[model samples]
Target: MPIILLLQLSNQTGLLSLGDLLLQAATVLHEGVVQVVGSSSAFAAIKSDGSGIIWGDAAKGGDSSRVEHRLQEGVVQVVGSSSAFAAIKSDGSVFSLVSTACGGDISCFEHQLQEGVVQVVSNYLAFAAVKSDGSVITWGDAAKGGDSSRVEHRLQEGVVQVVGSSSAFAAIKSDGSIIIWGDAAHGGDISRVEHRLQEGVVQVVGSSSAFAAIKSDGSVITWGAPANGGDISRVEHRLRE
Candidate 1:
């Protein structure tokens, strides 16, 4: 096996003590921490052997004692919401910790997530998974992109990528179009830019209250709440470059 290394094991400003503890345990540190993820008040890391280690606020998923058995090995990726963490294993299985409010409880979508997941993305209080079949599965707060019922047909297949803001989700289909859902004020609705979103949306980015799509022609279109990021008309010319 190769020797994995740690880069900034903890927050420099307020987590130096924990960083020191992690550094002092040279053997554990030597095992390697390949990745680290943090929620509002907790942190979790995955080791090279595919195991997960967590610390920080227990209520926010920092403690993994309860799910240690499942996360002992074979883990591939970890994602964090505002108050919880979810792990995806090599077999495509999923496990979560923390409160349901933060999307920690995903029992609602367990059947679809049994296997075949390729990626997972989260908003402030929900999670969306892209399956191997190109379908999407969501859970957590309904107002935050948890429920895809409104656009279930569109998300059934051909979705190549998914992005989430604090309260909404945007899916980029293979055809280069985009589908959105969640809070209408926070990137859920793109009707204002529907004309521009017809096709050729190469990329989509979001802020707390809006989403901006970069078209193939190098133009930009934005929609959602006007303040947080929706209104970009003032700089539309500059954005073209």
Candidate 2:
């Protein structure tokens, strides 16, 4: 069990949730900047230095700023799709490289995004962001990826990470449990296997039809369609759990 601590400061008072503090510490430990690709029709990159770049599929590259052979630096994160790209910069600016109409015109692309976008993820049809505050934002096809209006309740505070399949998304909280939405048959119910999930799940990955989680000890647990997840017993020993 984790111990909770309360701290008081003059003129300013706030609750430092134990999980929040641990997540902050973990962020320091896993310090490398991350870059996600293969979301939209195009490709993009978000560097650790807070710069971003986009390329490919001119049709999806919507910057009227003149199609340059290369993009400027300062991208903190990038996501792609079959025809478009989206990026979040260190300054909390969100930009898109797609048909202007695809993201709702230049104004939409230029809108100031919420702060603290720690990670960006996308699938073939949409994009998702995991903020440092442990909240998630999603946009794209409503059925495929556009605005996760219906499943907002599935994601709550304490979510530490997220992964996207071709059409769905899964999030893992610090507690080692999982939550999934989109394409129900594709590992969405892995959370129901809570009894099998032990403490210390460190990471998760999603395939077309299944989910894989790596425990702290390096062992892995998988659930969903057996055929898509592969024969677990054969590689069980290779896992660290």
Candidate 3:
């Protein structure tokens, strides 16, 4: 018989797996597999049964109706945003369920969107997709969602990660440095080093008015208006001798 397993993803329990049950002879025997996704506004999971599910934000198509049950067996990755959800299938096709600009009587043909996407990310006002070859596609408001035409150079070939702030976006490369565009005040400039950009940054986060980066050593760095960036003095102290 084929082996069976169950995997659950939840913040409360993290990732847990369970195997077969013990038979009357005390011999372990597990039959079917089950996967449970617990209470999270956003959840992503790859089950032991080789299936996947992503659910969150009804307005963004978190409801089951948006995704075909048959496709669940082929899902490999999932991602969610404030108002949208995206999933990737084993075959590399991307599926999306999102709210239309207007409410009520929305048609799936009007809201359901798909593409051959390799990676995806979404913010409050827009969604971005990075193709397998490193080019990016975006939809939603050109201002808040991102205007790819502006940073055509950085989007070329070396982009490895993308981050969005309330009003702007940033892309990080395989190297330690970053390329920022939109809303200059939001730390879009790399000419001056801020505490967060001082160390070799591994990850970045964009808040309403600032940018924050996490160093490889697990320390955080932040820049932009102090009020919005959060006082990093404490973080600096922790990292300092």
Candidate 4:
């Protein structure tokens, strides 16, 4: 990548130990930086050719040496959670690196993420990937949205979009039904308003610990910690227009 992109990455202040090498590299490179992404403690940069370089605190996603070979080519996009990085390749294959404690390890779900992944979203400590077949794959801290097994059956297919809150995840299926999981306090549990979320939902938005869904009828449904936007009865009358 160009020295300019590296310059931008430095601005994030996440760059560490490798600061010297990055600075020296910038002095000679004149190409272009394709992309740059950062986790809480590190940053990853993509070369014009789709390869990548990373630097920061090793334990917090600063290291990419382990997957250096895989990141050499065909990388289309890369994303980071609070402490991990996940890269998507041109073939639809996904590779995760660093911080196993925060969703970096993909070994267990290698089969599920092999190909056909269309989108990936992450919160503070987990990741949720949407496949071409409409299936969803989740991993990371189970308490922070990694374990979707609770609603695994509902994620089998028809999922059109996935949204994440700080400690939970919500999936909006093709039939307009909604599925939620993760820490209930973070909007992961929707049992309180389950009946109201059955269908007609058009979009879903999330706060750090809450979620708000707008339905086809223009009404909104919320559930989580009442303070985080899980309740709207106080302003319900004003939204009727």
Using lDDT as the measure, the top candidate is: 4
> Which model, 1 or 3, shows the larger TM-score?
1
Candidate 4: tens digits of C-alpha lDDT, residues 90-138: 8999999778999998888989898999999999999999999999999
Q: What is the lDDT ranking, best to worst?
A: 4, 1, 2, 3
Query: Cα lDDT of all candidates, in order?
Result: 0.83, 0.58, 0.54, 0.85
The digit string of per-residue lDDT tens for model 2 on 1-241 reads 2222111112235765656754553443244435746433444444465434443344654232342222354566566655566666666655565554343232432332546778777665666777777777776664544456666775646778888776667777777766666654655555556565646777888787677877777778887667788238777876644
List, residue by residue over 181-239, the lDDT tens digit for candidate 1.
99998989888777778789889888877888888988888888888879988898798
Best candidate (score: TM-score): 4
Q: After superposition, how far is residue 103 of candidate 2 from its true place, in Å?
A: 7.4
Order of candidates by TM-score, top first? 4, 1, 2, 3
Supply candidate 3's per-residue lDDT for 27.
Answer: 26
Every model's Cα RMSD, please? 6.8, 16.3, 10.6, 5.5
Considering summed lDDT, which 10 consecutive residues are worst modelled in model 2?
A: 1-10
